[model samples]
Target: MGKVKISAVSYTNTLPFIYGLQHSPVMDAISLSLDVPSTCAHKLIQGEADLGIVPVAALPIIPHAEIVSDYCLGATGAVNSVFIYSEKPIEAIKSLRLDGQSRTSNTLARILLRHYWKNETVSLVSGGAEAYVEIGDRTFGKQHAHPYVYDLSWHWQAFTGLPFAFAVWVANKPLESSFIQAFNDALAFGLDQRDALIAELPPRIDFDYRQYLMENIDYGYNEEKKQAVALFLSLMESLEDPKAAESLAKRDLPK
Candidate 1:
C-alpha cells in the first residue's frame, strides 16, 4: 500500500495529533507535512497532499475531500488561541487586518464582527491593525495590549449560541476502514500522553505553552462539533455570493 500523505497545521493546537501519529502504528504507513492553516488547505486543494487538517472555511474549495476521521480541532467555547488583538475596542474599529493563518477564521471573525457589533463596519483587509486578528502559536502571550482582543470562538457563541469547529481531518479520496481505524488509534495514543508530548516541545514559544496546550484546547470530534460544522457549511451556503454558495454545495464530503 502507498503511504498516506497527510498535511497538518503547524500550530501548537495540533501537537497532540502529530505526536499521536509519530507513535502510532500508522506512523510508518504515512508521510507527513506541516504548514500554516491556510497553506495546509492550499496544499490539499492543489493535490500536493492526500489528507489535511483543513480549515472549515476552505472545505468548500476542494471538490472531492472526505472526512476520513471523526476528529477535529474544536472548542465548546472560547478557544484561547485564535484572537483579534486590536488597538481600540472592537466597537471602535474601522478596518482590521487578518493574520494570514486560516481562511476559516477570517470568515468567522467577519461573521461575529457583523453579528454582535453590528454598528461597527469592520473591514478584513491584509494590513496592519487598527485592529488585527492572529491565530495559532505565533500570538500566544506576546502581548499587544493596545487593541482589545476577541477570542473568535467566544465571539461566535455570543453571536449564534453554538459551539465552533476550527479544522477537521479531510482526505482527498476515501480510504478503507482499516486505514481509518489505524489513524484513530494513533490519535488516541497521542491524546493519552499529553504531558509527555508537551515536554517534547521546545522553549522560546513565549507563552505558558504546556498549560495552554493541555488546558485551553479541546481536540475532539464529538456530536456538537459535527453539528457546528454542518451549521457553518449551511451558513456558507446561504451567503449572498453565488460563487461561495456553489462551492459549499459541490464539496463532496462523506455522509
Candidate 2:
C-alpha cells in the first residue's frame, strides 16, 4: 500500500507524538505533515489526509471519524496552556477575542462562557476584546499578563468532574489492524521518552515543563475521558440550540 497520509498538530504539546512517529519504524509506513489544529480538521474533513490527531470538537463534523488510538491530548485539571485571559472578571467581561491556531480551544472557551460561567454578554471579536482565548505554546507564562486567567480544562473538570480530551488520534477510514498496533507501540515509546525529549527542548523560566507535561497534561485515553468527550460533543452540538444549552447550564460547571 502507499504511505498512509497523516495530518498532525504542529504545536509544542504534540511534539512527543511527532517525535515518536518520526523516530520509530512506523515512520516508514506513513507520510506525515504537521499543521495547526484547524488545518488538521480541515484535511481530514476534505479527505486530504487519511488520519489526524484532531480536536474533539471536529469529530462530529468529520466524515466517518473514528478514534483509533489509545492516547490523546488531555487534561484532568488546570491545563496551563489553554486559557481565557482578561483584565476584568469573567462575569464583567463584555467581549472576547479568540486564538487563531485552534478551533477546539476557541469552542471550549465559548462553551464555558455560555454554560459554566453563565456569562452570555461576551461578544467574540477579531481584535481588542476584553478577554481572549489562547491555547498551545502561546499561552505559556501568560497567566500573569491578565488579572484573570481562566483555565478552560480546569473549568471543564470542575463542571463535569471528568477529564477532558482536547484532541485524539482519528482515522477517516478503518485501517489494517497490524498498522494500528504498530502506531500505538510507537506512540507509547515516544511517551516513555518524554523525560529525555523534554531535556532537549529549550528551557523556559516562566513555565514549568515538567509539571505541565507530567501533571497538567493527561495523555492517556481511558473510558472516563471517552465519556467526557461524548458529553463535550453533546454540549458542543447544543450550542446550535439554545433550549438544549439551557438545560446544560443547569448541570455543567467549572473549577
Candidate 3:
C-alpha cells in the first residue's frame, strides 16, 4: 500500500506535533501536508488526506470520522489565540464576523455570546461585522487594538468550568494497528521536546511565546477534554436552529 497521507494545521500550537512527525521513525510511512485549519478539514473530508488535525467544529460535517490521536490543541483558561475583538463591548455589539480561518472558534464565540453574554441580536457575518472572531498566530499581541477583547477559552471555562478542545487528530477511516502505534509515538516524541521547540521559535515582543505554549495551551486528550467535547456538542444541539443542530449531530458518534 502507499504511504498514509496526513494533513496538519500550520500554526504555532501544532509545532510540536509537526516536529515529532518530521523527526520520528514513522516519517517514512506517512506523507505530511501543512495547511490552515479549514483546509485541513477540507482535505480530510474530501479524501485528499487519510488523516487531519482538524477543528472540533468540523467534525459534525465529516462523515464516519474518528479521533485517532491522544493529543489535542486545548486550553484550560486562556488560549490567547482565539479572541473576539470589538470596538464596543460584546453585549452592545450588533453584529459579529466569523473568522475565515476557523470553524471551532467561530462556533465557540457564537455559543458564548448567546448563552453566557445574553446577546440576542448578534448576527454572524462573513465580513463587515462590528465585532470579529480571530484565531491563530495573527491574534497574538493584537489584543490592545480592540476595546473589548473576549478570549473564548477563558470565557468557556468561566461559563462551564471545563477545558476546551480546539483541534484534534482525526481519521476518516481505520488504519493498521502498527500505524496507529507509530502515530502515537510520533506525537509523544513531539510533546516531550516542547521545551526545545519553544527555544527555537523566534522571539515576539507583543506576547510571551514561552508562556503561551507552555502555560496557556494544554496539549492532552484526557477525560476532561472528552467531557468538554461532549458538553460542547450537546450545547450545539440545544440551539434553536435545526440546521445547526443537525450539522453538529453528524459527529455525535458513540464514544
Candidate 4:
C-alpha cells in the first residue's frame, strides 16, 4: 500500500507527536497534514485522510471511527488553552459565539454552562455574542479582555474530579497491526523528548509554554481517561437530539 495519509492538530500541544512522526523511521511510510481539530475530524469523515488526531467529541458522530493510539491530548486540572471569554459575568451572558476552529471546545462550553454553571438561558449565536468559546493558541494572552474567563477543562475537573481527554488519535477503519504498532512507537519516542522539543520553541509572553506542556497536559490513554471519555460522550448524548442519540446508541458504541 501507499503512504498512509494522517491529519493532526496544529496546536503546540501536539508538537511532541509531530516531532516523533517527522523524525521517526515511520516518516517514510506516512504523510502528515496539520489542521484545526474540527477539520481533522472532517477530513477523516470525508475519507480525505486515513487517520487523524481528532477531538474526542467528534468520535461518536463519525461512522466506523476507531481510536488508534495509546496517547491523547488531555488535561489533569486546568487546560489553559480552552476558554469561554465573556465581556459580562457568566450569569449575565445570554448567548455565546462558538469558536470557528474547534467543535469539542464549543460543545464543552455548552455542557459546562448547562450543567455546572446552571445557566440554561444561554444560547449559541453565530456571532456578536457577549461571550465566546475560544480554543488552541488563539486563547493565549486573550484572557485579559474578558471579565469572566472560564477554563473549560478546569470547570470539567471541578464538576467531575477527573482528568479530561480532549483529543485522541483515530482511524476510520482497521489497519495492519504492525503499522499500528509502529505508529504508537513513533508517538512514544516524541513524547519522551518533550524537554528537547520545548527548548527549541520560541518564547511566548502570554503563558509559560514549558510549564503548560509539562504540568497541565497529560499525554497517555489509560483506564481513567477511558472512563472520562465514556462519561463525556454520555453527557454529549444527553445534549443531542433524542432521535440522533438513540440512532448512535444502536451502533453499539460504549455507553
Candidate 5:
C-alpha cells in the first residue's frame, strides 16, 4: 500500500542498477537506499527493508527469503575483484582477517581456506593477520600489490565448478505482482545502461572499468547462477552450524 523500501549496494559495480532505479517508472512506487553489501543484508534481515540486492550468504538467515529480481553481481571466473591478499602463501599463512563490508566474501574466504585450499589451521584474526579478504571498489588495482592474491570467485568455481553469484535481489516477504514487474523493468533498464554508466565514472589508468563491468561481472541471474547461489547458501549454512562444519572439516584434508 505504501512505498516499498529497497536497498542496494553502494559500489562501482552497482552504478548501472542505481542509474536504472533512479530513471525508471518504479522510482515513484518505491523508496531506495544505498549501503555496503553487509549493511544491505542487515537491513533486509532486520525488517528495515522490504527488498535488497543482498549478499547470497545472508539469504539462508533472512526469514522467508524470496529472490525478486532477475539479476545479480556474479562472475564466471577471475572476476578481477574479490581477493585474498596474503603476505605468505595460503598454506603457510597462520592468521587471516576479513572484510567488514561483505558477509558473503568473508564467508567465501573462510570456505575456501577450510575446504578448497585444505588449510584449516589458519586462524581468522581481527587485525594484522597474514592475509585479509577484500572486495568491491576497494579491491581495484590491488592485485599487483600483494605477493599472493587469490581470487575468491575463481577458487569457488574451481571448487564447485559453478559460476559465483555474490549478491541477488531478495525480498523477505511476498510483494504485489505489479510492483515486482515494475521493479524488474527498472533493474533491466539499469543493466542496459552499464556502458554509459562506466563512461560517466572518473577515468582510471590502473583498472579497466569497461572490462570489469562488461566481462568480469555477469549481470544475468540465469539458471546456472541460480544453482551456484543455492549451492553457496547451503555451504554457508553448513559452516554456520558447528556440527556440520566439523563434519565438513574432517573430509576436507587429504589423507
Candidate 6:
C-alpha cells in the first residue's frame, strides 16, 4: 500500500508529535503535511489526508474518523497561547470574531462565552479592526498583553470543572488494532522526550518555553482524558446538528 497521508498542526504544542514522526522508525510509512488547525481539519475532510491532528470542533464533520492515539494538544489551566482580545470585558462584548487559524479553539472560545460568560451574540471572523480572537504564537507580544484577554482553557475549567483538550489525533479509516497499538507506543515515546522537543523550538518565543511545555500541557489519552474529550464533543453537539452528534456520542471514543 502507498504511505498514509497525514496532516498535523504547525503550532508550538504540536512540535513534539511532529518531531516524533520525523525521527520515528515509521517516518517512511506516512506522508505528512503541516498546516494550521483549521487547514488540518479541511485536509482530512477533503480526503487529501487519511489522518490528522485536528481541531476537536471538526470531529462532527468527519464520517467515521476515530481518535488513533493517546496524546493531544491540551491545557490543564490557562494555555497562555489561545486568547480573546477584546475592547470590553467578555461579558460586555456585543460582537466576537475568530482568528481564522483554528476550528477547535474558535469553538472552544464560543463554548466558554456561551456557557461560562453568559454571552449570547458571539460571531466568528478572520480579522476585525475592532476586536478579535487569536491563537498560537501570533497572539503573543503587545497584542496579547494589551487586551482584556480571556483564556479559553481557563474559562472552560471554571465552567465545566474539567481539563480541556483542544486538538486530538484522529484517523479517517479504522486501523487494524495492531496499527492503533503502534501509534500509541510512538506517542508515549514522543511525550517522554518532551525536553528534547523543547530544545528544537524556534527562538521567536520569549517565555520559559521548556517549563511551559512541562507544566501547562497534558498529553495523556487515558480514560479520564477521554471522558473530558467526550464532554467537549457532547457540548459541541448541542450547538451543532443534534442528529449527527447523537451518532458520534454512541461511537467508542479514544482512551
* Candidate of highest TM-score: 2
Residue 31, model 2: Cα distance from true site in angstroms:
0.6
RMSD in angstroms between candidate 6 and the native structure over all alpha carbons: 4.5
Cα RMSD (angstroms) for every candidate in the order listed: 4.8, 1.9, 4.0, 3.7, 2.3, 4.5
Expressed as tens digits, the lDDT of each residue in 61-142 for candidate 6 is 9768888887888888788788888888888777777777877777777767766677877655545633567888676554
Q: What is the C-alpha lDDT of each candidate?
A: 0.79, 0.88, 0.88, 0.87, 0.88, 0.76
Reference-based TM-score of each model: 0.88, 0.94, 0.92, 0.93, 0.94, 0.86
Q: lDDT per residue, candidate 3, 1-255, as tens digits?
A: 689999999989999999999889999999999999999999888999998999998888776899988899999999999999998989899999898898888889888887788897988777798899999988989989978898999999998888999999999988898999999999999989989998898888888988887888899999989999977877665565778656655754222
Residue lDDT tens for model 5, 122-183: 88789889999999999998889989999999989988888989999999988999999988
Q: Indicate whether candidate 2 or candidate 4 has the larger TM-score.
A: 2
Q: lDDT by residue for model 2 over 151-213, one digit each (tens)?
A: 999988887799899999999988999999999998888888889888988999999888887
Candidate 2: residue 123 Cα off by (Å)? 1.1
The candidate 4 region of ten consecutive residues with least summed lDDT is 246-255
The regions of model 3 sitting more than 4 angstroms off are 240-255
Screening candidate 1 with a backbone cut-off below 3 angstroms (N, C-alpha, C), the clashing residue pairs are 86-147, 87-147
- Can you write out model 1's per-residue Cα lDDT over 4-89, one digit (the tens) per residue? 88999988899889999998879888999989999889988999888889999888888697887777888767788888888777
lDDT, candidate 5, at 61: 83
Clash count list over all predictions: 2, 1, 0, 0, 0, 1
Consecutive 10-residue window with the lowest summed lDDT within model 5:
246-255
Which is the winner by TM-score between candidate 5 and candidate 6? Answer: 5
TM-score of 6: 0.86
